[model samples]
Target: MSSSSVVAFTLGASFASIASAVVFFLRARRQVQKVRGSPDQVVEVQPPHPTWTAGQKQPNPFGHSRTVSFRSTDVVGGSCYPLVISAYIPRPIALVSTISKNGVVNMAPFSYSGAMSHDPPIIAFSVCRKPGGMKKDTLDNIEENGEMVIHIMSEWFVNAANLTCSNFPPEQDEMKTAGLTPIPSVSVLPPRCEESAVQMECKLHSKQDIKNAAGKVTATLILAEVVMWHIHEDVYDDNSGQGPTTVKHDNLHVISRLGGNTYGTTTYVYDLPRPDRPKTGRKV
Candidate 1:
């Protein structure tokens, strides 16, 4: 074909592909709307494999098509952030509270946080810079004082926890604005949230700056050590006899972050025990 004809054909194909994607997206959205349940509707727990053996096959083994991969270097942070968060799924939220040098209180929710070690009790969380490369109050406060109180947000106060994420001034007290009561911490200067069932008084263990390909500092990863734990009696289970006590999942009502502005609950759950390999074939 001629160069002009080839160009015309390519443009036509591109437009057709774009149109198809738009139509498919609209149809999928409509299906989601149709399948959504009411707020008061009870969610049923269904076992993924009710009575399957060790080597049993799962349903729809090849239901999905070929996977598509995106190079991180090719996309901006705005495009990659959502894709990573969505794929990670059900991230635990850290409702971190800190106090400025001037005694100003700040509370914010971070989904990029989790426990790393049990012996030393280390919890690590990442704080991304605000728009225009400005540092977040949480990072600044922790760096200044090396102290903070991390709270596990529950379903009852998730809205309040989310409210703390607003870009309020450092002088503003986010706890009062969110209607969450803050009690004094035992080991840290930052107060603990009274509404949260699990509160950990932590001190800054260390920090690492995360840089992009351009060598610009984009986020700060804060590693904290839990010095003291404040757990509500309702959620504390002492079934371990002498060892460390565990939290009652049903009573805690822990809320986790999903993609976008979505929050998930531990409403539907199942237990799967780990299997041990046969001793006869074990390596020496």
Candidate 2:
């Protein structure tokens, strides 16, 4: 063959080989994509990099600025006063009712209350000193009688419950002032609010006095054991004998306290199932 014809033949073969390799690569890629699922449905996986390793400061994923730390003692109102009261997000409200030694009825609202145990049914609440460093009426009554009833605040009677928190005199009836009806309890001297959907009769189990740096009492922590529980039928779900009576959140419409004068409600709800761990013996 002529030299010119030979060169042209070699060039033609090279181009054909290049085109065949390109087609095979694209076809293989399509097969891999099909096995993995749709590209749009796949979530991008992020593996830990050197920035996330120990002793290495990782950039904020939330784009937040550098955080400033402060000691609780250095703060004006103490570390717990603001950090716990405000930064704690949402806290449940406890509408407590107590009776004085003279049979005077007193009712008040406290946000620093929660359940501490389930076996013996224990609950706890903290009460701060009133103005002029005097003990609160609720604490005084509880100390005298050793019995009180705690009612859960719902949306239907939240306003009335809030009114009970006012600084009323010991002689004044906060239940009457708030227009809330009080009914006789089954096992306690203090009455329960009829407006509340849930109520618990509690007897004093323990009491702790919290003192400040000056060694003066600043708050009282009361731990009580719940003797009986009263739950409204509307909020109780039997769940077809599968589990305990589930309190329907939507039906209860419970209200919670936030920072300052803010409040939260259970109107918006969502559920996310927990992911299962991989079978390779690694923690998820």
Candidate 3:
């Protein structure tokens, strides 16, 4: 073959290879774009702002002019009971039932009560001394017997529960005065309120006496260990194949003590999903 013809054939083959390579590259790029969706549909996401900061001052929704501040001494020492109660807006009410040494059943409601532990099941309540620094009948009964039943008050029996708080004589039965039926408790000497949806049979664990500056006992804090739980069938959620059993808040209609003469009920409910952190060490 002639030298010029050989060069021409080699150059034509090189040009064809370059054209094929370019077409293959373009097709691969198109496939990558298809897997990632349309380029124009892509939206840029921005991180959310931090809700709180250590030293940064946030915008005051109520404004500085509307804010009020007071010293702790002023509320505690002075006759500022309202301010003190307002600090703890909502508190659970415990209808404590106890039997005196003389076999008199006593029932009284105390707002200073809540669950302190769950593993061993512990509940606490505080009873303030009555006029002339006299110990309350509920406190006296628990001291003698070391056994009591704590009842959670629902909307149906809130009024009756409050009636039990009256200053009745030790001989007078407040449970009967309130028109509440008392059912025998399983593991305690004190009877449980039949009207209550939930009842806890507890044994007194410990008692702490809170004294004033003059060393006079002002209140007694009782810690009790729950031995048995009696939940009404309607309020009890026995998981049984359905998810974990939880007290239906709506059905329970639980009541809470507010400041002063005010009381509140659980009527509104909302839920928010918990955010999960990213594996890349980014906060959710």
lDDT values, one for every candidate: 0.82, 0.78, 0.78
| lDDT of model 2 at position 118 | 80
Displacement of the residue 165 alpha carbon in candidate 2, Å: 0.6
Which stretches in model 2 have alpha-carbon errors above 4 Å?
Answer: 1-62, 65-83, 272-284
Which residue pairs collide, candidate 2? none
TM-score of each: 0.76, 0.71, 0.72
List model 2 lDDT by residue over 150-173, tens digit each.
Answer: 988988788889999999989998
Q: Which structure is stronger by lDDT: 1 or 2?
A: 1
Check candidate 1 and list the clashing pairs. none
Better of 1 and 2 by TM-score: 1
Candidate 3 runs further than 4 Å off: 1-60, 65-80, 242-244, 273-284
lDDT winner, 1 or 3: 1
Cα displacement (angstroms), candidate 3, residue 140, comes to: 0.4
lDDT digits (tens) for residues 1-284 of candidate 3: 89999999977655554555555456545545544543223222222223434563333222222235423343244245576577686898888999998888999988888999887889999999997899999999998889999998888888899999888999998998899999999899999999999899999999999887678888899999999999888888855745555565556777889998888765433333236644333221
